[model samples]
Target: MRLTTIGFDADDTLWQNEQFFRVTEERFADLLTDYAESKHLKQRLLEAEMRNLKLYGFGIKGFTLSMIETALDVTAGKVPTSTIATIMEIGRELLQHPIEPLAHAAETLETLSGRYRLVLVTKGDLFDQERKLAQSGLGDFFDGVEIVSDKTVETYVRVFNRHGDGPDKSMMVGNSLKSDVIPAIRAGGWGVFVPHALTWAFEREEPPVNEPRFREVPDLGALATVLAEIEST
Candidate 1:
C-alpha cells in the first residue's frame, strides 16, 4: 500500500500538551479549594466544558475563562479577586507553554516528510494549536494543518476527501483512541493507536471495541517503525 496521505494528531502524539493542562488544573484547584472540593470542581468543570463546547466551540483560552466564571458564580466573591488574577496568569502561561516535541518527533518528521503527504489532523483550541505549531519547529512538515472542533466520523471523512479520498491508501497515527483511532477507521482508513505513557485522564480512557484495521504501539517513535513496515509491505 503506497501511503499517500498520512494524518497525525498533535497533542500528546507530537508534543507535550496534557502536561500543561495538568499543571493548569492543579493551579485551578488551589484557587477554588476554598469554595468547593477539588473533585467537585473538576466534575463541574468537565460538565461546563461539555456545555460550553456548544457555544464557544473549543480552545484553552475560552475553557479557562469559563472555569473562572463558574468559580466566580459558584463562590459569589468568596474566591478573592487575587485568585482570579492568578488564574489569568496561569492562562497566560498555558498560552506560552513550552512546546517540545516527543523523543523522535523531529527526526521522524524529517524522515517521513518527503516520503508521504503529511497533514496535521489535530483537534483543539485553534489559538493554542497555532501557538504550538509555530513554536515546535515541526509545523512546516505538514502539507496542511486541520484545527478541528471535534474529531468525529465526519471529520475523518472530510480529511480523506480533502486528500482525494483514497482511504485504504491513507493512515492516521495518534495517541487518543476516541479522537484519533475510531474516527479514522470509521472513514475506512487505517488507524494506528500510539499510547502515551502518561496521557491526561480524559484522553487516556477509551474502549477498544475490536476495530480490525487498528494497530497499537507505545508512542510516536514506534509509529514511525510501524509506518516504515507498512510501506515495505
Candidate 2:
C-alpha cells in the first residue's frame, strides 16, 4: 500500500541537538579534571547516563543529574560545590541552545506537508521539544506531534494509526537507526535512515540489512524522491 503518514524525529533530524550535548560534556569533563582525566570522566558520565535512564529518563534534566552523580562518584563525594554549579550552568546552556534547523529540513517539510500526513515523532524533554518546534517555524507543517519518552514498535503502531491509516501505510524518518528506524520498520512501517554527523553512542545499532521497507538517504533533501519511488513501487 502507498505510504500516507510520515513521522519525523525532532532532535538531530530536524534541528541541531547532539552537538550541544557534546559541548556540555566537554565542559563537564573540564570541571572534573582535578579528579579524573577527560577521557575517563566522559566514560563515567556515559555510564551514569545509561544507569540513570530508567530513573531520570531522557533530556537535559536527567543529563544534568547524571553529571552531578558522576562528579560525586569520581571525586569520592569531594567535588567542590562551585564545580557542581558550573556543571549545572553548562546544562542550562544546553537547555537554552538556539534551535538550528538542519539543511533541507525546512524545504523537505514544506514539500511533504500537504502531500502526506506528517507527524513529528520525537523523544526528549517535553518543554524543550515544544520550544524547538515553536522556534522552528515548521510546526504548522505537521498534522500531529508526538513528544514521546521512547520510540518502540508499539509507539509507531499507535502513532501511525492515530495520525493516518496504519503502520502499513506510514514511514518514520530520522537520524538514529535504533530509535527512529528499527522500531518503526518492526512495527510494519517504512523506516528511512538519514544519518546525522553524530549520534549518541547508545543509539547506534546495526541497520536492517535485508529489510525491503528500509531506505537510507544522504539527507532530508532526498526524502521526497525516496517517497516517490516507494509510491511508484
Best by lDDT: 2
Output the TM-score of candidate 2: 0.99
Candidate 1 lDDT over 76-187, as tens digits, reads 7577888888888888888888997888888878888878888898877887898889999998898888899888878888887786446777888888887888778888
- TM-score, every prediction: 0.90, 0.99
TM-score of 1: 0.90
Best by TM-score: 2
lDDT of candidate 2 over 1-233, digit per residue (tens): 88889999998998999999998888887777888999999999999999998888889999999999999999999989999888888888888999999999999999998889999999878998899999988899999999988899999999999999999999999999999999999999999999999899989999997999999999999998999899998
Estimate the lDDT of model 1.
Answer: 0.80
